[model samples]
Every structure is written in C-alpha cells, then in structure tokens.
Target: MTTLDSGERRRGSDTRPLITELIDEGTVESIAQEAWISLVGEDEVLVPLPGGPATDPVSSWVDVVGPWTGSVVLTTGRRTAEELTRALLREHSPAVLEEEDVADAFGEIANVVGGNVKAALPGPSGLSLPDVGSAPALRNPADLCRVELQWRGEPVSISVQGALPPLPAPR
Candidate 1:
C-alpha cells in the first residue's frame, strides 16, 4: 500500500495476514486487557502520550510485518503519565505501568493493536510500518477510518487510513 499525506508518498509492500489478527494474539498473550471498541473517526487529537517530562522527551519505533507496517512513539503530557497509567490500569493493580511505558504502549498500540485493525482491509496492499513516536508534530491520519479505545481511562487511537490508489499488492 502507498499513502499520500502532507505531500509525502509512502510505498508499502507486503502479503501477510491482517493486523487485527496479530493484535488478537498479542492482546490475549500480553497482560494488557481488552477494552472498548469504537467504529468511526475523530478530529486531530493534540493529546500526547504520558510519560517522562525530561531527557527521553520522545521516542518512536516503526516496523513492517506481513501485510502491514506500523510505528509507535512514546510521549509525555501535562496531566502526567502516572495519572494516566493509574487510570488505564484502574481495573488492575493501578501501578502496573508508568508514564514512560505509555510511549512503548503507544508504539505497541500502533504496531499490533493498530495493525490488527488496519489489516482488516480487503486487499493485501496495506501500510508500511507502525510508527511509534512523538515530536516533529505528529501527522494526523484523518483521511483513514480510525477507532478509539481507552485503557485505564487514557485514550488509545487506532487508525486505518489506506494507501492512495492502485490498491494492489506490491511487486
């Protein structure tokens, strides 16, 4: 799949299963519990991941697996990740994850979590990578359909925007 946003064309080529399937496996295996599911999109969310307010200002990770690719980035915020973490793990022991973990969570969310949903697309031509990151003014995937879920009250956004056109598998 190839995507065009902000004048940049991202080319992707993979032929594997869907991202949602991967997410199901991870969610079941991983300790993170399954939360609510929403069908629809939303406007740009200025909310950044909660974590460190220092040196590790931000970090992003991206990877391509099977029919899709993903990226994730750790972030920080005014509310503080600790508070957000508490809310997310509210059902659990509460202190389960720290703010720093939020970015990693975001990255993983973009990867397996976001991947699972994006993979649901009909064609094999999907995304290039799950980019986990922060800073540089995160681009909004407004064009694609997205879903929002909350973990301990914190919002985890999942987007399934498609590539430009010629929605065919890459060679």
Candidate 2:
C-alpha cells in the first residue's frame, strides 16, 4: 500500500468545528424560547439576563454524535425544575409532584433543545435520549457555548459543550 507524506493530514482528523463556532447564545436562546412556548406555556418567556447561580441545581442533557460529538445540557434549581414540570403538565399536573415527574419534564426540555442544536450543527448526527441529574463535566473550555436566562424569575442555564478534550498543539 502506498503511504502519504509525513506532514499530510488524515481525513476526519481535527476537522470538526468547536460547539461555539457552530452555535451562539442568540440561536440557543431562540431555540429555548420556542421550546418554552411549546412545552412550558404560551405566555412563558425566558428573560435574557443572568439570574445568578442556581441553588440545589439539577441538570438534564442529551449527547450528540456526528462530525462533532458533544452534549446539550440544561440546568436549573430543583424547585424551579418542579415548577417547570408543573408548567409543562399544565392542568394535568398533580398537586404533589414526584422526582420522576421533574426528571421527565426537565429531560424532555433538554431533548427538544438538544435536537434543535443537533440540527443546527453539520449533520448525519445521532442524538441520545435525554438524561437527568448532574451536569456533565466541561471537557473542553474552547468548545462551549452557554446562555444564562430567567424563566418565571428563576435561573436557568443552557450549555452546549464538546465531549472531547482539546487537541494538542502542533509542535
């Protein structure tokens, strides 16, 4: 078999764009706004302001794999998550919400946002089912796009971060 020159770059090596390059805070906010309108309530709006840090934070995310592999994560306080669950359920919500209820609703929000984010990226991508719990570690700082907002006066943050670590600098 014939081999290429030493300096030649391999196909599919270091070609994927970082998450920040592919998406921005505005696009992410619009996506989240649409999701909120559809899933939360017709009048619900996400105020585009940093609401500071969340207390007793909970997160939901979905993994995306394709030309770029990463996760789309949504985080908020536990009480806020419960409120979001109620809003999603609307009149169907029970007086006493269960942990599973919050998980299901919050995870669904992440799924919707992640699906849209995946569509925005260069495709032939695979999306994982949503997972709810702690946020995934930020593996590569350069590969992240994050937005902070307030929904019903509660803090919520959405972060799209690469799963892969940063590539080594060339010698």
Candidate 3:
C-alpha cells in the first residue's frame, strides 16, 4: 500500500484482523477444502507411483512476497492438480484460471490465506502477497518454513520462506 501526501500507509492502520476474518468466513475454508478434496479424495483411487519418472510428483508452493515468506508445500500429483482445476472451475465458476494465470491465483490464494492466518496472530500485516510454482527438488532441497494445514483431516503443507537477504535489513 502506497502513501498519500501525509506519508501514511494508504490502506489503514487498524482492524486488519476483522477484515481478514470476514474474508476467511466468506471464502477460504470452503474454496481450499473443496479444492483439496477434489484433487485428493479417499474415495478416488489413483495408481501409486514408485517414485520414478513418468510419475508426476505432487506440486508445491513457496510464498516469497512481502515480509511474510510462508510457503505451502503441497504434494499433488499431476493428475490430482488437473482434476482439481477442472472440478474447481466447473463447480465454483472461477472462470478457468489458466497456467498463465497461476501467478494471479497464487497471489490471490496467498493473500487470502495470509489474511486468515493473520487474524489468528496478534500482530499481522495486511495480507502478504502470494507466489506459487512447481518446485522440483534436486540434490539440495529448498529451505523454507513449513506449516501443515488440514481440511477435514487431509494434511497440506504450507511453507513460508524468508527474503533471501532478510527484508533489506528492516530499513
């Protein structure tokens, strides 16, 4: 949020929690839960891969925006991600966010989750922006803060990363 002539953060200074909680109540739980379940359901059977090539590993996300470097490391098979996308767009009418739109959706999801998560924290920022992508781990793994969020008992891990240089040394 930029500042006006007075040099104050234009968005506001008070009541971020209220704003985020309202959003969570309105959207996050339902959208995330449905999306997760559609991708990986106990009732649905998928051939277990032997952790080889041709077998698509689960997709994960890393949040690298603002002061909040939180990541959501999700293990979603290619099949699961595709199925989730189709089901989510069809049922929720989110207008079919394309792969090109991953950035947009990533930011949106991060913002939503951050807000809700912030509501739970006493001191919170105004919805950290989100970044998402398919990060394949090579010899050296990515170092990121990991948190698991479960919807109705299904666990999805979220990772939060620090700025490579720690937010410019806090001004």
Candidate 4:
C-alpha cells in the first residue's frame, strides 16, 4: 500500500463556523428563558425587548472549547443581579444580600445558559467553570451571537463570542 502525503491529509483552512452562523438571537433567548424559569423563578419570564443598556453592569461567563471556541456571557445591572440572587434563593435568601450571594447565583445562571449553548454547538466540546466580573472583550464582531432581554424590567444581554482573534489573512 502506498503512503499518503501529509499535505493531502491536512485539514482544510479554518472550516469552523462563527458563533453567529451556529446560533441565533431567538435560540439564545429561548435558552435564557428556560434558565430563568428553572433557576430564577417559575413565574419569571424574560421579555424579548431591548430595555436599553444596563446600569452598573456586571457580567458572568463560561468558556466553551471544541469545534467552536468562545465564551457565553451574561450581563446585567448589579441591582438586577442581586434581585436574581434573591429570586434564586427564595426563602433561603437573607434580607440583606451579600456580594458572594450575587456572585454565586449569577455564576450559576451563566453556567446553565453556557451549558445549553455548548450543547447546541457542534459536539466534543469542553466548558469552563463560570466566572463573575467584567465581560470579556469581544474578539471578532462577526463571530458574536447576542440576544437582548428584559427580566423584571431590567436589561440583560447574552453574548456568545469567540475567544480568539480573527485568523490572519490568507497568503
């Protein structure tokens, strides 16, 4: 049997699809809605309306790597995040919420949303643990899939953006 050439066996240049190509606003909204209902409250509904930019914004995200690599980010106002924590904890919530409570709840939300987003993408992927704080800078605008939503009159945005910068131009 003849040996195959290495060049012939090499994978074609950057065949991976962008986040926008793989996911849409509606799919992302649906995923967020399900997460809200399950984690925040059964009665809570994420209105698919742009409530404008968030005030005192805080973000939580989880990285996904595989056929596609990116971060699934959730951003909302600090007050809204605190409220979400309260909603999540229900009777377990203290009258005065702590920073740690907000972080844990918000991080959990990102984990749930990110997990679903990862599942929807092409398989054999790995998801990183959730992180809370500032949102990661968007690397490639074209590689982003975002959805704007309102929860209890608060603006929230979910963005799935590539972690790596755009590939260099072809020679």
Instruction: Provide the overall lDDT of each model, using Cα atoms, as 2-decimal numbers.
Output: 0.37, 0.94, 0.40, 0.92
Could you tell me the lDDT of residue 61 within candidate 3?
48
lDDT of 1 by residue, 1-171 (tens): 975474323443223333344444233222112321211112212232332233333333343333444332323332433444344344652445654566544444344543444444344544445443453232334223333334333444433332322235455
Per model, state how many residue pairs clash: 25, 0, 11, 0
Residue 129 miss distance in model 1 (angstroms)? 5.2
TM-score of 3: 0.39
Best by TM-score: 2
RMSD in Å for candidate 3, one decimal? 11.5
Mark the 10 consecutive residues where model 2 has the least summed lDDT. 7-16
What clash count does candidate 3 reach? 11
What tens digits encode model 3's per-residue C-alpha lDDT throughout 1-171? 965576345434421222222233324344444444444344532222222221353444433233333333344444534444454345653555566444443334445545544454344344434545564342112334333443323334443333343222221
Q: lDDT of model 2 at residue 126?
A: 100
Question: Per-candidate TM vs. native?
Answer: 0.34, 0.93, 0.39, 0.91
Evaluated at residue 32, the lDDT of candidate 1 is: 19
Best by lDDT: 2
Report the C-alpha displacement of residue 101, candidate 4, in angstroms.
0.7
Model 1 worst lDDT window (10 residues): 35-44
Tens-digit lDDT track for model 2 on 29-142? 999999999999889999999999999999999999998899999999999999999999989999899999999999999999999999999999999999999999999999
Candidate 2 yields a Cα-based lDDT of: 0.94
- lDDT for position 103 in model 4: 93
